[model samples]
Target: MTTNVLMTVPTGPGVGLTSVSVGLVRALEQQGLKASFFKPIAQPHPGDEGPDRSTAMVAQGSSLRPVEPIPLHEAERYLYNDNIDELMEEVVGRFQASVDNDSTIIVEGLAQIPGHPYATRLNKAIARTLDAGLVLVTAPNDMRVQDLEHHVEIAAGSYGGIKAHDVIGCILNKTIPGSLGAKSYGDQFARRPIFKRNFALLGQIPVAEELTYPRVKDVAEFLRARIINAGEMDTRRIQSYTLCARGVENVLEALRPGVLVFTPGDRTDVIMATAIAALNDIKIAALVLTGGYEPSAALIALCGKAMAKGLPILSVESNSWDTAIKMQSFNQEIPLDDKERILNVKEHIARCIDHDWINSFALNHEERKLSPPAFRYRLIEQARALNKRIVLPEGEEVRTIQAASICAERGIARCTLLGKEEEIRRIAQNNGIELNHGVEILDPDSIRERYVAPMVEIRKHKGLTDIVARELLQDQVVLGTMMLEQNHVDGLVSGAVHTTANTIRPALQLIKTSPDSSLVSSVFFMCLPDQVLVYGDCAINPDPSAEQLAEIAIQSADSARAFGIAPRVAMISYSTGGSGSGNDVEKVREATRIAQSRRPDLLIDGPLQYDAAIMEKVAQQKAPNSKVAGKATVFIFPDLNTGNTTYKAVQRSADVISIGPMLQGIRKPVNDLSRGALVDDIVYTIAITAIQAGSIGA
Candidate 1:
């Protein structure tokens, strides 16, 4: 299906919807997607034969050709006369004409205005009629969470009935940086149970001063002022306006770049001081003279010198107070000619919006479909939320170093690299990789003495002497494990340059399994094109008994749920529902029964072939009554050989990215990466490890 997105604001009126809409279209186009712009109904602009200001701005700012906007007067007339059917028919026809099979069509909706009590209903109808996914944009004001939830519910509702599925996501617009609205909701914005909303919480757009500032020309035009001395600075931006009613000395202190100085035309002292400030490289935006007065001949000549240096001077009939009040109430619209401001708007949007989610949505519009990028994004987001430290024992490896840099750059984890600081820096410099600020490097040899006694005291019962403990502590993995055991670090990730045994042996000896766990098992998060699947007992268990297999299934399901993937487990086998009886099939059947007996709340089904476990058609024919047959997210294998081989096969054949061999059942978090893992693989593994550490405390 072609990508069609309808952007509407919830309780708007300065919600910054126009800028966001244009920015989204531009962002999509920048990603090499052909995106078109359409405004079905637009506010009326004076003497404008073309599109509205926002629509025209998008056309001028990007390559997207503008479609004709339905005039506000015509739309209001149609609605007032109760001819909505005819209105919708014409609107749908116009939208279809603008749509292309290959290009994405971005439809802009009406802003919150008077006489539009049914704005939400009208927008929902338009989205439904256009078969477009609705994106609700809301700004941060005095709105509480309950108010936002009510607004979302209302936006999802239509005139006829509720259609929550019509809404794809919501955007918290113009949020203040570091405010509660920006940090509180966070990555859990969509998943919070209090909201009871299934739509994606795309992200928050912080208040950008550049986007909020109005251009000098726009302000002048809005106030109906006459330009006394015009130059090449008509496009200068005004961040704030100031009244020059005070003395010249007081006004001089308040003068700053982007400040539009407002004073009476007779205030020659203030006007001359401002002109002098402009000439001194203070860079004032413009000068607005009130009281319908113009500068005297000598004063005009003095102002003409500054105007020659590219400063605008305007004269208005209203006094300073009235002018200031009018300026405050003026609607801040990005002028079509202000290309720099428009570019700033687009860039701000590109940086703030959820790029991974939107890119995935553009490619595939299915709800709840976890695209690979979005899956990786969620992992990083969760890890950043935890902000836990993870030790990397294979720090000398190039991939480990690069992965640490990435994790640090993304704030995914605080990575402590176990290696000589100078040596790691040399390797990083030689490889042309810059370490991020969040990465810490330590020499394992330097920390050996402090951990020797602690290591010996723990393993003294197993005949480990101080000398032996000191020697073992020299190993990077051992030292990292000691750090975890002593609560110095939150988690550990190793094995990129070493074998899996080299990584797991130290954790098993020092960290040990949790009291609830019978044995430690491993699982891989297989990121498919459409979803993330968990493959369990893949690396740890060699030939697990039914009891151990059941434990692995339960652990895998719990791990899946912890990471935000719902746990619908399918105990995989060579047979479906006793179609063939064998030791392997019987083992899977027994494990399924045992797992169900232990955790009755889990959605688990067993003794099903691979096809019957995941393919809906095959599941219907083979295990029709099974609850988790066709939608299994966690796959528990009977043995390690079967699990490992199947996971690798799926990974290679389908070109899927598999993260982990994440060791479950551990008291603290310690994971082993594949020896040949890529940089991204290590990054995600560290993130997963950090998240596990957060769940279990330090």
Candidate 2:
């Protein structure tokens, strides 16, 4: 049977109006209801001049056509020119046009109140004309609960007057408990003997992280920008809903097995209410706070203790009401049309789609900081795009010089090479590599005098005199990096003749880490013919601690994502889960814990044997509930022994094309190549280094 529901986003920042609208649609659809949504009023263009991505997400599963954008003035026209009766007629007309009579129609109104010229009053009034029931969304904060009085007043105005049987109900969103601003208000509203019987809360929609942020495609389509934070986004995992308790009934009803966000600032009543909600072990991620509202010193201490023990806490500026609404709106991230059917569709899509592909799409569109894949054409185009100074450590190669010459001719970075000018010229001429005009050629023997003094000064604390430092700085690669560090060049590409260590050591000791990270590590692309895997710690750390392993997982996951791979981290150990347990298992488990603690946003599983980490059937027989086990793209080795042996064994036995032991966690992408590395290895190293430079600022 058709079930027509009118949904209104409650007033508050981060309120889940859009999200609830979407989720409700999904829930309804799952319950065998044919659902459709009506956004009679919607913001025209948020950023880009494209169709709203929200509408697209909601309609993703539908056989129906996409929602047509409603002009900003359409609401005004219907209310003013068309008249009230005619406005309802049009609403019904559009509803009928959008869905078959057997399908349920959900009318989504604007968020603002009437008389506030910009409020979605027009949509509400139209809903009234259609004789639809109303669902009011509110944050479960005391203040938000209190605000419901005014919202109810406003909602009543849409219907000409408040009615006893209007079917108006409340949906509280983003409920981190103990922040009772909404609870106080909602309680007071219910206690008022006159208006007491008018309102009933239908459901309390808890907060879910995936629902909070827009999807990568949606963000990309909205911003019209590329993603630079590729790795970070890949590491982000979606968690279940966390709710705030606005009332005892709301608390009892809202408390499901999902995560719940609770504030330390709640009264005993609210705390007890939430205590009951915590019976389920769906994984409590954190407790969030609004407006930097720190709980009392005692509660803060309590939470701090939890955090110390690896529990989490998330804080945002919007109050409880806003948090609730925003939590519900997480459904918007999926671009669903009907609010009721949004949740189911998104969950299905989340399960069905390859997260890595979604991550890759997001990498291209979001943050715009991560480097794109090393497409040969894009690499050449990038070199031709900027005018920064470029340095080639091994400037003697004919191919290297040829590439440099092409760059110079294109007005890209100025090319500088370390070689004897006469020798370079002879090789260029003999190999048909053009010596582009204005390219600077420096000989190690001749340039020592110019750079030795500066190198000595830069490393003055090393107790080296100018002469001694000059001898140490004799290596041309070292001199080249010094030049880049001294701002003489904007970028560098080398490692053709050099070992990975030989190429990177100079940069590491001299250039230093970026402001954001503390240590450097290595990551290899591990590109199998069919898919790419990211392996770490085969280069830098001989044997890392739990903390270091965690860092490696986070960083490698990021690296995998940068190259368009989904990063499900398998923290590999000798034992699978607790099987064959020992310090080794403890180390892997500890590392996994630290990684999750540090990121708290990544999908990481540890204490897993290599087989369990990679093979789905094996994982199913082992840690059946683990999400990252079989799908892991990033593998964290418990120690250097296992990590090295596993990678080499896989490389030899499977005949897979392994790209790294790519060094990461470093300030720059200074890659290490194995002894007797091929020309293809050198090319890939250059591509990686170039990609790093392109994505450096991020």
Best by TM-score: 1
The whole-model lDDT of each prediction reads 0.79, 0.57
In candidate 1, position 453 carries an lDDT of 89
After superposition of all CA atoms, the RMSD between model 1 and the true structure is 16.1
Identify the runs in model 2 with alpha carbons over 4 angstroms from their true place: 1-390, 398-415, 432-440, 445-447, 491-493, 652-655
How many pairs collide in each candidate, listed in order? 0, 67
Name the best candidate (by lDDT). Answer: 1
lDDT of 2 by residue, 527-637 (tens): 452345777766677788787788888888877766556678988887877677777688778998888888777788888887888788998999899998877778887
Q: After superposition, how far is residue 489 of candidate 1 from its true place, in Å?
A: 0.5
Q: What overall lDDT, based on C-alpha atoms, would model 2 receive against the true structure?
A: 0.57
